[model samples]
Each structure stands twice: as C-alpha cells, then as structure tokens.
Target: MRTLVSRLAVALLGLTLVAALAEPVPAQKRGGTLTIVRPTDPVSLEPNLETTAPGAWVYFNMLEGLLTLDEKMQIKPVLATSYEVMSPTKVRFKLRPGVKFHDGTPFNAAAVKFTYDRALHGTPPARWASLAGSLAGAEAVDDLTVDILTREPYGPILRTLAMYCMGIVSPAAVQRLGADFSRAPVGTGPFKFVEWKTNTHVIIERHADYWGDKALVDRVIFKVVPEEGARMIALQTGDADMVLFPSPAQLPALRRDPKYTVHETTGIRVVFVGMHAGLPPLDDVRVRQALLHAVDRQAILDNIMEGSAGPARGVLAPGVFGYKDMQLDRVYPFDRARARALLGKAGFTPGPDGIGGGQGAVPRVGHGVPAAPRQPAQPPSVHAGLGDVERGCRLLALRALPFEAGAAGRVEHVAV
Candidate 1:
C-alpha cells in the first residue's frame, strides 16, 4: 500500500511537472505546427525489424522497449518497472499497470514475449542483436509480468535494451497492421501517430493520457524538405518551428536574424565522406590524405558551415564511448605543397600538359572508378547505415535518438 501511495505521489508530481512545463509553452500553445527535418525515411515500424537510420530512433519514441535508459545515460526501468535476476541467464519483469497501445491492446507480459521473439527472428536483428537478445526467451509469468532468459552475461545488455531495436510492439497490432504498422505506430508514447504523407510530412499528436508527464507540445510535425537552404527558409517564414540538421552555411543567416534561433547539439554521429578505400588512386593512403588535405577544413567550417559543426576527430562522434580524436594523425596538414608532393610521389607529376604518371587512365581508386583499359570500373557500397520506456521508456528512446545522421543518403525507410 505504501509503495502504491509512493507511485501515486510520483504520478501526481509528474502531472504537476507537465503543467509547469506546458504553462509557458508559447509557441506550442499556439499549436500551429512543428516542421522537423529528419534525414532518410523509415523502412518499417515493426520495432524488432527496423533497419533504417530514422526508423530506429523514431520508432523507439513511438514504441516502448523492455529496458530503458535514464537522463544520465544509465539503463533504467521502462516497460518492466522492475526486474529480478533469478540467475545469470534468468530474469523477471514487473510490468507497469494500465498502459495500453494506441490500438487499445494491453502492454503486458505476453506482448513482451512476442516482441522479443520477433526481434530474434527478424531481418535487422544483426544490427541490434545485443540489445534485443539479452534475453534468450520470455515467458508471461502473469498478465502484468514476464520473465526473460539470457544466453550469456552480455555486458551491455541493459544499455542495448535501451535501443530502438528492443522497442516493444503489439501482437494484435502487428497482425492487423502488418507492414503498414510504421505508418501508424501504436506505442504507449506521449504522442500518438496521427498521419503521414510519404516524402511530404508526418504528424504526431500528443497523448494526453500518457503514462508519464504529458508532452508540452500539442503536436509534432516532421516536414520533409531536403535542401539545407529551404529548411531554414521555412523557419524564417514561420512555416516551421524547428530544423533538425541545418547545413553550416545557413548559420550566419540565422545568427543575423531575430525571429530564428539555432540550437546546436553535439551528438554521437560522425559526419564525414566515406571514400572507398579500394578505389584506385584513393586506394593509396597518400591519395586519401591528399584529397582530405586538399579540401580546406577550416574554409568549409568558415564558409559552408559557419563554424557550428563540431570538428570531427575520429569515425565516431563525440559522446560515444571509446571514441578517440585521431584527426591529426589521420588527416594530412593543410599544405598545398604537401598535397602536390604526395600526388607527384604516386608517379603523377603535373607536366606542362596537366597530366602525368606512366599509368593507364586516372586509376579509379574507390568504389566506382572509370574503367581503365586494364581494370574494371565499379563503385563500392560503403554507405549503410534504438528505445525505451514505459515512463522510463520514453526517456531512454528519445535520448538514444538524440544524434542526427544528417542528410546522408536518399530518403529510404531502413537506413541499415
């Protein structure tokens, strides 16, 4: 009874907090619209089956995962309010009471079992194996609880669970909706899927009956404007509330204006061109270094990006664990002379006729190189590219989706 009272008290506090947060939401209260820009399209909404970049992050917000992450980036309670590890391989979940999917299906132990089963037997499992399979099996202990078994002592099991791949879905909804599920996600999130017009926009209405604090915004409208300049223009013209990944060049224009404010957040996404290593000239380390060095990093920052982009040091962006700043070692110094020398060393000296190297055709370096008489021309495919909560679930899902992949590729569903 005391624990119940404590839960009630916390619930009341969350309600109060919701009001406190919403009270001053001037723009949100107006309920005009929020045109959010997210790169790429969603492949599918079957939580365990999502593979695209946007789908993984967005679905987590629209769905609930078994495990969750806290604001401090620690793993915490989400769908299963609490758990007991009977043994290293065995664990139990205490489901949150009264939570329901948009389809009105109860989010219970059976649902948990079904969700993970699909995850282990899904298409994108390879990308999310750790998070989705921390539990080898799940059994409904009761209507409101379930038990899970892990194959091994996965070190980051809980953290992995806090990813979109581990997000829970309804068995009923999956059966009824099938592949169309992504178009109308029905998680217990603060927002419910309202409508989506492919390549145009997506609209999500705030869920007033949310288990946690109700969202401050009445609605979130994700707009699909591809160009960097157009996104800022929308904000400037009051057509958009926020822009997700603004190009660097537009920073100055925004800074010079009063109606717009740019919020730059450094995240765990590395934004850099991936040159195919197998490509001819590029195959040479000197060539990669030369090309990178030839391009003025400082100029790109100053002219194109307006210094807003965090200087990428390594493959992984900042905030990611084990990421090291190896830019200095990996990148060549910004010296035209060095670039010229490197090119020359490769047997390609700039002769009076602007060509060189006793070679056959400018050796195609990376994925797609023009076919030389001696070599075949081809392009390599290097471009390929998580979740939570009940109340804790929402928190974890949003946090994990914090970074922006930027406008990397064509708008597709599964970025994986």
Candidate 2:
C-alpha cells in the first residue's frame, strides 16, 4: 500500500533520508501546493484505462512511461531515450527528441504507435490488456523511432514497459478527445492534467514544458479523503500534505508526532488469503495443506500489520522483479497440532461437540483489515483447528471496502 512513488518521493524531493544522515542537506525549495490525502477516487485519467491504485495515484502525476523504475528497481529510459533488444520478438524504441504531449502533441514515433495501437486494439479492452499481454504489435520506426512487437521472448518486456499501463498517451489527445480523452487527461508528465472533481478533487499542474527535473510542486492536490479517520483528520487539520493508509492503530500515535513524517517503505502489494480450489473442501490437498497450517502468518505480521507487513513469502512482493524464495520446499509453521493432523487426514474427525462433525463450511472471505482484529485472530485460528461445527470452517465474511470497493467485492464473490 505505501508507494505513491514512495509518497511522491518524499513530497517532490525535499530529500530527507533522515535529513541526509543528520544535517547539511537543506536547500531544495521550489513553489508549493502538495495536498495528497487519498483513500480512493480516481479510477481513470486514462493511463491505458487504468486499473486502480486510485488510478495509479492520479495517472502517476499525469503519465509518461516509455520505461522507468529506478530507486534501484533498475530499468530506466523515460519516453524512451534508448532501448534495443531488437530480435527475440523485437523492441527498438529511441524517442525523446524534445518531447511534448501535454496536449500540444508531437511526442512521436506516432505517439509510440498510437499508444500501443490503442492498447492492442481498444474499445473496452484496455487495462493495458492485463499488462500488455505480451504485446505483439506497435511499429512506427521513423519519427523518433519505435518497434515493440512481442508475442513471445518477452522477459517482462522492460518491466512491461515500465508499467502505469504503459502510459504514453495523447495520440493527438486521443484523436481529439474521443471518449473525452478519459476525462480530459493528456501527458508527457511532471504534472499536467488539472481538474477532476468527481469524488471531490484531483488537480496536477507544473509541467512548464517539462522534459525533466522540473516539478518541485506547483500543484498536486489528489485529496479524496475516504476516511482512515478522515485521512488522519486531513493530516492533522492543515488539510493534508500527504496521507495514504495511515492508521495501523494510529501508527504509534503517528510516530510520536513531531508534526508527522511517517514514510516507511517495502510494499510491492501482496496480501493473500485466496482459496476456492475447485470447491469441495478446497479440493483437498490435505484440505489445502490444512488451510496453510491454520492461519498465524507470524500472527498476521504481529497482530494485523502493526509490524507494518513482511510475512508474504510468495506472490512477488519483496521488491518485485521476479521475486522468489517461495519458502523453498515446505514450511507452513503455525501447526495447531499440524492443523488437526491435516483435518484428520482430510476425512474430518472431532465430534462430541469438538466440532468438525459434518465438515463443509470454510468460507472466510475478507477485505482490508478491521474485522475486529481479524475476528479474534483468523476465524479463531482456523476454528480452533476445525472443531467448531456451527458450520465448521468459519469466519465467513469481513468486507471492509474501498480499494475499488474491496476489489469489486472480491470479484463479485469470486463469480458466485
């Protein structure tokens, strides 16, 4: 969750790595307006028909992407100032000659082949086709050059063209505001798009012909405030200069409040707890390894993320790019007697009111924190190892909402 590019790189680089190791690093001053405070609102400023992270924290401050990353996550080149890997299904790039697109058009190579041929052929399809589903199109090779192609040999094609749905828009402002260019968005980025208001707020500004090193904030806004106690009371009443998911029980009183600065990091977003494995008691692989050894992933990273997250060993969260350590060969530790001996070897034992009597209910679907400290620690630690029989495997719902309405109600309750 933390990472609106590390909170706008510490609010547009006032650069404070603990005040550059304690002193002598001050002079950065430039313009002003910052505001932030988001918890929702911003489903599309059209970066390839965005897929929420609040529309990537406002089209990543108005979009640009011809590869990006760095902060040591490697892969650079911005509106493609260089690229090559031109064979195993091609690549090429090269653009960046006096870039433009804040709607005065001309960012060329046919606007990166009309923004990847309108996200590989648009009209209700672009969520950048699930991260450029191995692209396979895009040409141009002249104006400033371009190539792209791919339907194979795609080793994460330059981190999927540095994400934010492979940005690069303004094919003449999407052919002169077609679908109203997704509510008036246009880009080359370092801020531009200036107005949204929908669930109240989203601004942007700067970009005075920006082509690099220019945004020291002359407007940013964002501000939706969908309550984490009203975005910490709009950052303690000065009306927020930055706030996003702040309230892991008031983060130790906002880190002992010295006018607040709480910027912790490491979050590539991964919070698991998925199951439906072809139903019938999760299609028994010893009852899905006894519900991953009955909860307690370090007691949900110490009582529901107050230790600020770190127990997800898989689904790629530890600094992303092909993350591994899938707990190398077996290790699901919290053994409630090895989850009741793998639910009595998937046959469901325990009766005389100790529960698992008829063995069929394992529902537990959740969304964002607060379900009374995960219902007294994950369905009472897997219904105290499957012996609670009021419909055995319990804690069937948590629903805390607002990450795109709890991921569209967990994809319509996993498609019913």
Overlapping backbone residue pairs in candidate 1 total: 26
Q: Which 10 residues in a row give candidate 1 its minimum summed lDDT?
A: 1-10
What are the Cα lDDT values of the candidates? 0.52, 0.63
Q: Write the per-residue lDDT of candidate 1 for residues 134-210, one digit (tens) a residue.
A: 55767889998787777887555566667656667778987898778767777877778888777677778877777
lDDT over C-alpha atoms for residue 247 of model 2 = 52
Misplaced by over 4 Å in model 2 are 1-34, 39-55, 64-106, 110-135, 141-166, 169-187, 190-205, 210-217, 221-227, 230-232, 241-279, 282-354, 359-391, 394-416
Steric clash pairs (candidate 2):
none
TM-scores vs. true structure, each candidate: 0.65, 0.32
Off by over 4 Å in 1: 1-58, 68-72, 83-93, 123-152, 256-262, 272-296, 327-363, 366-416
Q: At residue 355, give the lDDT of candidate 2.
A: 48
